[model samples]
Target: MATIREELQAAVKKLFDDDKIDYFVGYAEDYGHTFPAILTKDSDPSRLTFDRKSYDNLANFLPELRGSRVGLICKQCEVRTLNVLAAEEQVERDKLVVVGVPCPAMLDPRKLTEGAADLDSLDESYWQEKCRRCLERNTPLADVFVGERVSTPTPAEGWPLLEEVEKMSAEERLAWWRRQMSLCIRCYACRLACPLCYCHQCFVEDNKPQWIDKSVAPENNLHYHIIRAVHLAGRCIECQECSRVCPVGIPVDVLNNVLSRDFAERFGYVSGETAETQPALTRYERDDKEDFIL
Candidate 1:
């Protein structure tokens, strides 16, 4: 059995040789950090790697490279992101050749590193919380599989963090979130890292109306996060990239996760599960509850 790296190298080399794709997106190590890279025909395919340390969702780079034929190394999460992009009609599916890898989950660098250290010593305990609830270890939309299928454990209950947050009284929850929001420096790293935040003119940047305060006030930070969560309410795919990139270590995914759980419970809808499924907020039914209306 070939390792995933070898198989991906061969597959990408073939794609390049056959001129099937103009670019290949995969992971590479640089300065001891695993980051996503775009490979060309002239680039070495051996640089392509699959590891738990690889955290960037390669699909986030797709919108920038639109109109070019692309071969993407899709982990389960990236596949789900692509599905969401497809749902929003942000991408042309025919232009993409997906090379899927069964995700082994991902590790949080903050847990294993003081500044910058090798991940060789870390165990699964340091893996991201998202992996514990992952149901898509196998690529559901792979055009080609590059490795042996892997299995992941299912948690006894889902949305444990959201449940915990809900258990807090309203005032306590408000105080808790304000503490978290106060840590934000208003750097848009989360917005820049999010694939779904593809807007060319984000509301935060509008000088005409100045929708969100540009200052670093705690209230402004809370407003930004809440509005961002609302924008992604029906579309967030739980990739956790925003939380991963937050310099202040904010648990930014919690807001999105709460909405995702509500969507699942109320409408029986899961975002990014399939491209064909309509977004929960996009369509309405006559029988839908209207109790929330004033």
Candidate 2:
């Protein structure tokens, strides 16, 4: 009996050997950390591994590999990203071979390693918050499913963070965000880490119009984040990679999550849920609710 990792490696190797895919994207362990690895037919499949620490969205590499036949691992969130990219025609579905895995929640190494010397000492509290609320632990869109089926737990009730923020007065909320913005060092780690942010020229990098100043000031940081959030309103897949990669520990996903929730609540849209379901902001309806209109 083979483990899931073995099964995934076998699948990828088979595809590569059969010449069905030109490259493979999955997690490989090296240098004491599991990171995204690109594998070819000549690559060693034995290096591939799966664990809570395999937190990167493999789809981030898809844009760079466009037009090439690619086989890649897909967790629930990564599958959703593929769907969104497919809906936007950013990817050619025929060129992809998806090996879906039943995600068992990713770990936040920062929390689990702060006091613990070994991973086994960590408990459920170390799992990412998004995993607790995940609705798609099993991807339905895989070309081939790996591992045994695992049931996703029912998400806990209520959006506690959103509720807490909603309770803050407008001024208090503004001040709170200002403080968060001040902590940003303009590293753009959040932008670079996001799979959906594949724009060849992001607004902040444009000097022709100088859309936003290239400074580390709080105002510029706020402006950059606001523009990013607006651009991702109906497109973000809530992977939390932005928040995960922030060197300054900003909760960038909070902004994206708030917008996602609002889009779902108001427009009955959830990004990447389905290819046929039009994106909320990309389409218009005569009867669209206008309560938010000023």
Candidate 3:
């Protein structure tokens, strides 16, 4: 397996030499953990450093460079996010230089900082729960991909947490979720941090529709999140950014993962596989399953 450092070095060097891109959007080493930074000049090619702990979604950086050519690092989930963004016209496909990498699940930031002495050491931190049952570790699409192609265990086995929740009574499930939602502050950090939620005017921010109230009450918080989850239903790429940015440390992956699981099971679908593919909610079959819808 080629290390992230090596792959990044070679990719940046070539991108510079070929003039394939004007900027490199990848991780740069910081005090301890890596941070997302851009390398614009060829003389600064040395700035591109990718390591095991490079976990932020690079797709989140694309919008700022809307009309320009740029190189981006894509792990499995980032690729899904990018494809969805591209399909929705949030990003320009022609202007992007695709760089794919193999992702070995991301470490939970909270768990990593719990007992870890240094950031580099967190490479071995306990990964987020969603990553435990990840279906893809490496990106499936790229113009110039790097890293040894690895295999992931079948994702069809089913999500454990979702099943456990399903085993609960309706009131029990509602109570469980109420506690989690009550912890939220309605900060909108999860929505802002997500690449998929890149709408210029978010539904929550709309005055006319007033899709959700801007209050910090539990009802408002739960309403906002539930609507956010519904809006992203088939469109969510499962990048887990929504969960990652949660201040209260709510396991928001449970929401996205549930929708993703249903999308796959009910529609035989996976988000962001292709820009040409219609999103799960945007299209439907005449004889589709609707036992619960009615």
Q: What are the per-residue Cα lDDT tens digits for candidate 1 across 1-294?
A: 888888989999999999999999989876766789899999987777888888988889999999999999887788778988988888899999999888877887677756545454456688888777677788787888888887767743587677888899999999999999899998899988999999989999998988977889889999999999999998998889999999999989999998998888777787888768777788898776667673
Q: Candidate 2 or 3, higher TM-score?
A: 2
- For every model shown, the clashing-pair count is 0, 0, 0
The parts of candidate 2 lying over 4 Å away from their true place are 114-123, 285-287
List the lowest-lDDT window of 10 residues for candidate 2. 113-122
Error of 2 at 10 (Å): 1.1
TM-score between model 3 and native: 0.87
Candidate that beats the other on TM-score, 1 or 3, i.e. the better one: 1
Per-residue alpha-carbon lDDT of candidate 3 for residues 1-294, written as tens digits (9 for 90 to 100): 666678777888898788888888888886776778888764565556766567788888888888888888888777778878877778888889888777766777777644466544444337766566566777767878777766775653676677888899999999999998889987888988888877778887898978777877778888888888888888887777787888888877788878888888777888887757666776889877887779
Write down the TM-score of every candidate: 0.93, 0.94, 0.87
Candidate 2 Cα RMSD after full superposition onto the native fold (Å): 1.8
Regions of candidate 3 where Cα sits further than 4 Å from its true position:
1-3, 113-125
Tens digit of per-residue lDDT, candidate 2, span 1-294: 889988988888789878999999999998888899998889999989877789998888999999999988888778888888888888898999988888888888667644466564456688787787787788777898888878989976556666787799999999888999999999898988899998988988899999998878888899999999999999998899998989888888888888898887887787888657666677998777898784
Can you give the lDDT of residue 240 in candidate 1?
90
Quote the lDDT for 267 in model 3.
78
